[model samples]
Target chain A: MPNNIATVLSRQDTWRGRSQRLPRRTITTGHNNLDLLLQGGWPISVLTELMPQQSGIGELSLLLPTIKYYADNNQLCVWLDPPYQPYAPRLAAADIALDKLLVVRSKNHAEWLWAAEQSIRSGALLLAWTKQPPPRYADLRKLQLAAADNGNAAFLFSAPSAMSAPSPAALRLELQSLEINQLLLNVRKQRGVAGGAQLQLSLGEANTQRTNLALLPADRHRTYPVRQFNN
Target chain B: MLKRDIWLYLHFPLLPLEALLPQLPTEQAQKPIAIINLQKNIQRVLCCNTQAAAWGIEPDLSISTALALCPELELLSRQIEQEQQLLQQLALVAYSFSPVVILTDSGSLNHSSVPSNHSSGLWLEISGCYKLFKGYDALLRELDYRLRSQSITAVNGIGQNPLAAKLLCGPDFETQLPDQTEIQRRLLNADLSLLEINRKQQQSFKQLGLNTVGDLLALPRSALSRRFNAELMLTIAQLNNEKPFNAPRFQPANSFRDLIQNPQGIFNKESLLFPMKTLLQHLCQYLMARQCHCREIEWHFEPLIGESQKMQIQLSGSQNNWSTLLMLSRLQLERLELPRSIEQIILYADQFIEAPMGVFNLDLFDNQKTAQQSCELIDSLNARLGIDALSQPILNQDYLPEQASTLATPGKHSNTSLNKKLKAPQPLWLLTDPAPVHLRNKKLYWRQPLTIISGPERLCGNWWQAEQQRDYYLACDSNGARYWLFRETSSQRWFVHGLFS
Candidate 1:
C-alpha cells in the first residue's frame, strides 16, 4: 500500500493543495489616483465594505461612477434602506440611469437582511448597496459566499465604529472628508494585497468653484486675482 | 343522436375518518377511535378506524356498546358541517380531473322514484378527457395516486352512464376499470336492492323470485312496467344509456371565499397556521385550474368573545403560489396580538388576472427567473411591511430644491424619465426640513464658523400660491461638512437645505 501511494504521488500531473489566484476583472473608482493606489480597481464578484467617518462625507459620491457604469450597460443597482431619500436631480447630474436603480426599505433588520441576500443571489450583472448595523460574523460570511457567485459587486455601508471589529469583507475602507470638494480614503483591509494605503481624490467639476479677484505680487500686502476654494 | 358518455364514480368510504385524522397526533392514530353522532336518544357511531373495527366496533353500533367492547377506545363527536365542507373540498379535487364534476349524496338523485341507499361520492365524465390524459387507465391511475397522497380511502367504478357507475361502486369495487359491456354485466348481476324503490315494490320483486337486475330485465318490458311503475321504467332506460339525463355540472366561481370553523377555537397563533395552510392550498389549486391569479387576500378572524378583526394583504403583483402566501400570512400573524380566542377564519379574494400558461423555470442560473424570484421576495416584504417602506427617488417639476424631487414607489414607474431633462446638480441627501442658520458680520455659523466656496444661484417659483425667492450657495464648515444653503431675499434669513455627500 505504501509503494502504491508513493507511485501516485510521483505522477507528473497530480493536483495538490489549494489554488492561490486573484480575480482579474475590476471596476474603476472613477479617480485614476485612487484606482492606482488599489492596484487596478475594486475587484468584481466580492463584498466591499465602506465605512464613512460621518454622515454626508461624499460617501455616495465615491460609488456613483461605478453605479453609472453598470447602469449604462443595462445592469441593475439596488439600494437597501438608504439613510435619506435619494435626490433625483443629483443622480441625473451624475449620469445615473434611474430606471435601472432599485431602492428597498425594509421595516426591520431581518427583512433588510433577507432582501439583501436575495438580491446578491439573483445572478444579475448588478451592484447592491446597503446601509446596516454592524452584522455578526456569520451574516457577513453568508453575504460573502453569495457574492462569490453573483458575478457582480456589493457595497456595504456601515459606521466607522466597525473598523476595530473583524469582518469577512473582501475589501474594507474608511472614507473621510479632508476639506471642501476633497476626500481621503484609508484602506484598512483588502484581499490579495496589504492594507493601510491613504489616497486623495478631487471632487467633480460642479463641486469645484473658481472666482477671480484683483491680485498683487508676492511679499506685497495685496488682494490679487486668485482662484478661491478649498485646498 | 344519443351519445355514449363514460362516467367514473369515486366513493370515499373513509372521508369522515380522514378529515379528522390530520388533527390527531401521530401516536394517537394507531389506537381505536370512533366518531359518534346522537340521533334521538341513541349515540350511534358514524365512522370508525380499522383499529376500532378490529375491536368489534362498527358504524351504526351504539356508542355505549362499542365502548364496552373496546374499553380503551377514543371517541369524538361528529360535526356534520365539517363533513359537508370536506365533501366540497373533495369535489374541488375531482374538478381537477374533469370539467364536469358532480357531487352526489343520498338526495342528490331527487328525481328518482325509488328509495335506494346512496353514499356521498363524486362523479366525473371522462369520455372527452381520456385522449388528453393518454387513456382512461392512465387517468384513473393518476386520480388514484392523487387521492392516496391525501390519505383518503376511496372506491371507484366506471360505466356507460352515471347510474350504472354509482350502483357498481359497491364495497367490493375498490379499483374496477370496466368497459361498456362489462358494466352491463356487472349491473345485471347486482342485487335489486341497489335500486331506489318503495319497500312494497322491493318486496314484490323478491317475492317474484327476481334476484338480480338481469332477472328483472329478462321479463317483458311492458309487463315489468305494469308490475312496477313509470319511474322504474325510466330508471332502467337511463341505466342502459337509452335515456340521457343531464347531471347538473359543478362550475367554479370567479372569486374565492372560504370559512373554516373550528368549534374549539384556535387558542394560539401556532394553531391558526394549520387551517390557514389548508385554505391557502385549496385556493391555489382553485386559481391554477382557472388559469388566474389574485392580487390581494383579506383575512377575517372572528373571535368567540369579541368583535372580529380583519387584516388585508396587498401583493405587489398577481400571484398564486400557496407556500409564498402562507409565508406572508405567517409573518402578518406573528406580529398580531389576539384579543380573544378565534372561533372562525374567513378568507376572501376578488381581484384576479388571467395567467399565461407556461412552465416555471426552477434553475437558479436563469437570469429572468431569478429576477422574478427577487421581485416576489420584495413583494413578500412589502406585504408584511407597508408599501411606503420601499421607495425610489423621482424628479418633480418644481423649482424649490426640497420640492424638485420626491421618493416614488419602487417598480411602479421609471424614476429616470423626468430626471434626464433636469439641468441642475442636486445634493444626494436633503434635510427633512430646512434648518435656519445664523449669519452675522458676513460670516456663516453652523455650530462653528463656515466658509463659502461658491454660489448665489438665484431661483424663484410658485407665485400663484405663495411667492418665494432665494439665493443658494455651496459652503463647508470647519469639520469638512459641505452644506447647501439658501438665503431668502425677502427676510434676509439663511437656511440649510441639503448635504453634498
Candidate 2:
C-alpha cells in the first residue's frame, strides 16, 4: 500500500512536469525568429507584460500577429485603452479578424481593472490587453488568477516610467527601437528561462536601405550585444 | 373520450387596492390605505386595504367617514385606468394556466372611465390542464400560489361555464362547482342577489319572497319568462347549459404598448422604477401568454412640453425573463437624465420570437445556459456603459493601413467584410495619425535616428478621394526597435506608420 501511494504521488508530479504528456498548446507571435527565441511562442494561461520605452513604438505590432491567430480561431481579443487610436487600415492589413477584436474603454484605472478582470474570467475571450498605470500587487495578482482560471493570455502594457515598479506577471519584456527596420527585445523576466536575454530582430524590406543616417542622435546611438539562446 | 369542459373563475374584489399594495413602502404599507374616488360630488372609498377593512372602513364608505373610522387612514385617489390595466394583467396570468381566458367585466368592454363596484373577474377553461397538474387541487394550489406571489388577493371558483364560474366566485358564494348535480344544488342554495340584476329588480324579487335561486326556479318557467326580460331568460338557460353563451376569448397581444400618465411629474430617478416595474411586469405576462420573447424595448417619455424623447434597449437575443430585463433597464435608467419631468411614460415592444425550448430539451452540456448567461452579462455591461463604448475590430478593405481596419459594435459586423482575405503581411499596430520623421543620409529618425535595412514597397491610391503616394519600409531605431516608416514621394517627408512587435 505504501508503494502504491508513492506511485500515485509520482503520477501527480508527472502531471505537472508534463514530460510524458502531450505538449500544452501555445499562441505563436507569427515571427519565426521571436518564436524560436521564446521556445514555441507565448505560453497559454499566463500574464505577459510588454514594457515599452515610449508610446508609438512598434510594441503593439509585436502582439498583433498572435492576436490575429486567436481571432481567426473564433476567440476574442480585447484591447483596453490603447494609447493611440488603432488605425483600422493597418489592422486589416495585418490579417486580423476585425469582428473578433473588442475595444473596451473606461474612465479610470479601477474601471479598467474591473473590465480586464471580468474579460479574463469570462473565458469566452482568448486574449486581453490593458494599458494603464502600474497596478497594485494585489490587482495584478487578481488578474493573473483570473487569466489562469479562464485559460487566457493577458498582456499588460506599462509605461517606461513603471520599469522600477514590481510586477506579478509571468513574463516581462522591454521593447526598444534599434532602427526604423530593426528592434531589440530585452527579456527582463520569464518563469522558467534565465532573464536578461536581448534579441535583435530585422523587420520589413531588405533592399531599399537608402535611409538618412545623419538625422539620428549620435550620443544615443549605442549597440548592445545580442544574447544567444540554446534551445 | 374528451372530458367535459371546466372553467375556473378568479375574482379580485379589491383590485384597486391590491394593485398598489406590492409597491408600497414597508412603513406605509402597514397603515390603512384606501382608494377614494368621487361619486355624485362626494368623495367615497372605492377600495380599502385589509387593515382599513378591519377598522370598518370598507368600500362605498364616505372618505370622511373612513378617515374618522381609522385616524391613520391613508387615502389615495382611485385610478380607473390603473384598475383596467390590472384586470388585463390578471387575464394574462389566467391565460398562462389555460388558453381560453375571458375577462368577465361587462363594463370594461366599453372602456368606461368610471370605476365599477362589481368585482372584476376572469374565466379560465381548465379541464384540459387539470390532469397535467395531477389534479384540480394541485392546480388550484399552484394557481393560488402564483397569484399570491404577484401580491394579488383572489377568490377562486370552478364551474362548467363562464356564468356558473362567475356566480361561484364571490366571497359569499361557493368556491367549487364539482358536477352538474352539485352545481344545481349550489345554484339553488345561492342568494338571488348573486344574479346580474339591478337594485330595483332585486328589491322587487325580495318583495315577492324569492330570496334564493331555488325560490325563483320553483315557479312556472312560462310564468317567470313572462314576468322577466329575455336577458334574464338567457341567463337562466346559460346556468343550465341549455343555451350556448358567446363571450369573447381574450388573446394576448402580439406587441406591448402601455401609456402611464404621471399626473404629478416624477423628478427622482428612483421614483420612476415603480411605474417601470409595473409596466415591465405587464409586458412579461403579455409575452408569457403569447409564448414569445422580446429582444428590444422602447421607452417613450413625454415631458410636460415638447415632443417625447425615446430610449431603446436592444438585447443580443430574445429574453422572456422580467427580472433580467428590469435589471438591464435599471442600469440604463441610472445613467439617463430626464430633461423635463412632465407628462406620461410609454413602454412598447414589437421585436419578439418564439421562446426557446425547455432546459431539458437543450444541449446536454448546458451550452445554451452558458451562452445565455454570457449574453446577459454583455447586455448589462452595454447598459451600464454606452452601447457605442463597446466595439470589436473588423477589417476594412482599404489599402491604407489607417483605413484597413474599423471598430464595429459587436454582433453587427458585416459578414462580407469579415471574409475578406489578406494579401500580404502588415504591421500589427498603426498609429491613429502618422507622425512626420526626418531622413538624413540613408537613415530614418523619429525622436532618435534609425537605420533602414529594408527595401521600399511603394503604394499609391485614392485618386477619387484624397490622393496619396508613399514608399514604405521597415527600419530600426538606435535602441534596437523596429518601425514601419514611409516616405511621401511628392514631398520626400518621412513618417512612422507602425511598429514591429
TM-score of only chain B in every candidate structure: 0.82, 0.80
lDDT of 1 by residue, A1-231 (tens): 125766544432234466344324566555556656665555666788888887677888877777776666555577877776677777777667675676777766676677677767654333334445567778888887667655467888878888898988889999888986688889999776799988877775555432111221122112211122221
- lDDT tens digits, residue span B1-501, model 2: 646678777888778887666545668889989988788888888888778889998878897788788998999887666777778877888888888888865422324534545557778888888668888667777788888787787887666767777776656323333676776677778888988776877887888899887888788779888878877777887776678667788887767887667656867778777888878888988987887889899988788878777778989768877788888888888777775684678899999988877732546654555456456656766787778768766566666766665667877876544344533345556676888887668666688887775758877768554348888887766565657788888788889887654
In terms of lDDT, the poorest run of 10 residues in model 2 chain B is B106-115
lDDT per residue as tens, model 1, B301-393: 999888898878777657888888888888777667764788889899888888745634455454445545555655665666557766667
- Estimate, for each residue in A20-91, the C-alpha lDDT of model 2 and write its tens digit: 432333455555556556655665567888887865556776666566656555555667777555655456
Q: What DockQ does each candidate score versus the true complex, computed on alpha carbons?
A: 0.33, 0.30
Docking class of 2: acceptable
- How high is the lDDT of residue A153 in model 2? 74
Residue A57 of model 1 has an lDDT of 73
- Model 2's DockQ score: 0.30
Q: Provide the overall lDDT of each model, using Cα atoms, as 2-decimal numbers.
A: 0.73, 0.70
| Candidate whose lDDT is highest | 1
